[model samples]
Structures are given as C-alpha cells and as structure tokens.
Target: MASIDMDAFAADWIAAWNSHDLNRIIAHYGSDIVFLSPIAEKLMGNGKVAGLDRLRRYWTAGLASQTDLKFELLHVLRGHECLTILYRNHKQQIVAETLEFDGDGKIQRAFACYQLEQG
Candidate 1:
C-alpha cells in the first residue's frame, strides 16, 4: 500500500515497541491518528485513543510497568492502504494490530485486538 514495504514496516514497528522509546514508537503515526485497542479501553476509559497527544499518554501509561515489554512478530498481512501485524507480547499474549496508512505512508489509524485467555 502506497509503495510501503510491509515487511520493513512490520519489522520497524516491532523494533520500536521493543526499544521502549515513546518517540520512536510514535514516529510511525500521523498527527491525526486514531487508535483502537482493548488496552486503550482500559487505560483511557474507552476503546478509542484519538489524536497523537492522547495516544502518547495512553501508551506511556501502558508501558509504565512493562519494562520487559517486547513483541515477537508472527505474521504480516497486507491489504489496501493497510497491514496487520500478528504477534505475541512479552506476557505471551497474542495480539493483532491492523494499521491503515495515509498518503504520506504514516499510520492514520490502527486497531489492536488480543486473543482471549484460555481457561
């Protein structure tokens, strides 16, 4: 999509998270980003984390206690103007993040879904 290399994008995304650098992680996003995540719902009182400022805050808080946070990429699914990264977190939770890119190739929107815990 938009001539963006999905493999490189996914690798950089995973690396950004693993680096635990807020600015590095946010660099992939556009200023008008809208991100949806279960973690966002828990942190921001809603599933929508609209805009860059709010997103930065939410992610910062989410990572506060996750010093060992890391992501292991499992799959990168490409689509029109979008891509989904399936990975396992340091906690061993399976997560899927679908990201839609803007004309500039910066992520304009994103959605994060987690696999339900097995009993």
Candidate 2:
C-alpha cells in the first residue's frame, strides 16, 4: 500500500469528487479496491465496476441528477494507517456518510446513514 499522506489524500479526494473528475477519482483507488455503497448490498470490486464506463453512468445519473449536490466535511479522525471522515451532503435533502479510508488512502468502506431535515 502506498503510504499516502492523510490530510493531502483527503483534500485531493474531496477535490476530485467535487470536480466530478471520474478519472482522477478512480486513479486514487487500486485496481482491486472494493466499494460498499449504501445502495449496494455487498462489497463491489473495481472489476465489477465494468471500468470507468459504469462510474460515469452513476456520476451523471445519481450524483449529477441532484439539484444541489454539495458536501461538507464534518470531522476527520486518523489512526495508524486508517482515516475516517464524517461528511454531510447538502442538496435538496441532507444526507450524511462516514467513509473509512484504507492505508493506501483509498476508501475501503463507507457507511451512509440518511435523515430528512426540515429547512
């Protein structure tokens, strides 16, 4: 695993994501990396992604589809070689997620719990 600098890695991840740069985002992950999205039942492999082709579909269909897809970093906790970030999605609705990053600074697991807020 690449000994990635935590703070820099987190910043880059958020920047790439917010920019909607699929290529840059995918570059941060390993070829064998796994993703556990809230919408998925089981862990999904990079191969299962069908490559970036599938990512574009979700990026446009799921994320871009939202009216105001904004995210704010609530907190970040670091361990020996792991990092967890609490973030809130501010759009038409408010959603929160805590992402766990592996030693390589790639997201290994993500837990997303949602709630509706009256604003």
Candidate 3:
C-alpha cells in the first residue's frame, strides 16, 4: 500500500469539515464504511452506522444541528493503515478519531471519542 501523506490528508479533511459540505467530507470514506461515535446515537438512533447511505443521513443531521461547526486539528498520528486525529470542535469539545483505511485509501472504519468539559 502506498503511504498516505497524513499532513495533506489532515489538511483536506479539516477543510472538508469546516466547509460543511457533506459530499466533500464523505468523499474520504468508502461506501461500505462503518462509523462509530457517541453523537451517532443521538443523531441516528445508534452508536454505529454502516454504509454510505446511513453515514450520509447521520452526517446530514449532525451538520444541520450544528450551524457553526468547525474542526480545529491539533495532532495526527499515523499507523500502517490508519490515522488518529485530535481536534477541537466549535463547541470547545476535544475529539479524537481513528480512521482505518481500505486498500483504496478510503476510510473503511472510524471510531470517535470526545472530551466533554465539566461545568
């Protein structure tokens, strides 16, 4: 497998999130991808979503809910076929996502965690 430029990918990924363009953001994932996030349960009625269609629905709802959504990338850790990204959301939530890529360099599976601030 060809090495992916983590920096470049991170830049584009951040741009896509900041753009709030679902198509652009989803372009990084594979059709059969599986995504797991805590927010997914609230948005999609489940903590895990599979396939592009479901992912689209979940992401659409998320974007609609957050009108001022923006991702501030903090760090990136690269693996053989995966990348872990640390970022801050518009709501001041710190998020970490691990993405596992397919042979085609598309994200096949992703897991997200968030650090919620205590009041």
Candidate 4:
C-alpha cells in the first residue's frame, strides 16, 4: 500500500471545501465517512447520507448560517491513513474547527468549536 501524504491531502481537502462543490467534495471521501460539526444538530455518517442528495442538504444547511468562511491551516498530523488538521475560521465570527481524515483521503471525523466575537 502507498503511504498517505497528509500535507498534500490536507491542502486538497481545503481547496475542495473552498470550491463549494458538494459533489466534488464528497467524491474525496470514502464510503463510511463521518462528519461532525458544531452547527449540525445531529451527527452524520455515510449511511445517513446514501448519496449526494443528502450531502447537499447537509452542506447547504451547515454553511448557510455563516457569512464569511475563511480557513487557515495551522498544523497537520499524519497517522497510518489519517490526518488531523488544526484550523481557524474567520467569518462574521471567529471559530476553530479540527478536521480528521481517514485512509481514503476522506474526512472520517471532525470537531468544530465556534464562538461569536464582539468588536
């Protein structure tokens, strides 16, 4: 098996997200991908999202609430076939989200911590 290049994968992941193409975004993940978000009222898995149909809804709903979605990659940790990312988001508010990816260059897990800033 080929070793996973966390840096390149992480970069591509961020690019895909910035593209805002849900289909292209999902195409990067494995079948059993898991998504966790502070905004998502419910945690989600691939089973919950059989295909792009539900993924679109999830993406739309998750991003619609935020005005500006700017992300800066702070760090990258590489595991056997996983990547852990530390990033900060600058939107109408400032927030941080941790993104983790599995073997297939897909997001297996995520943690989003967000708080509104006043200034």
List the RMSD of every prediction in angstroms: 0.8, 5.1, 1.1, 4.5
Model 4 lDDT per residue over 19-65, tens place: 66666777765555555554554545432443345556777765665
Runs of candidate 3 with Cα error greater than 4 angstroms are: none
Model 1 ranges off by over 4 Å: none
- Count clashing residue pairs in model 2: 0
lDDT of each: 0.94, 0.55, 0.91, 0.59
- Model 1: what TM-score? 0.96
Candidate 3 steric clashes = 0
* Model 4: residues with Cα > 4 Å off, grouped in runs: 42-53, 64-67, 92-105, 109-119
TM-score of each: 0.96, 0.61, 0.95, 0.64
lDDT of 2: 0.55
Alpha-carbon shift of residue 2 in model 3 (angstroms): 3.6
> Tens digit of lDDT per residue, candidate 2, span 1-119?
24766667667767776776667767765444444454433333332333345544555565545555566666666765456555666553344444455655565544455555666
Descending-TM-score candidate ranking: 1, 3, 4, 2
Q: Estimate candidate 1's alpha-carbon lDDT, on a 0 to 1 scale.
A: 0.94
* TM-score of model number 2: 0.61
lDDT of 3 by residue, 1-119 (tens): 25788879988999999999999999999999999998898766789999999999888988998999999999998877899999999989999999999988899999999997799
lDDT winner:
1
| Residue 49 CA displacement from its true place in model 1, Å | 0.4
Model 1: clashing residue pairs?
A: none
Return whichever of 1 and 3 wins on TM-score.
1
lDDT tens digits by residue: candidate 1, 32-62? 9999988878767899989999999988988
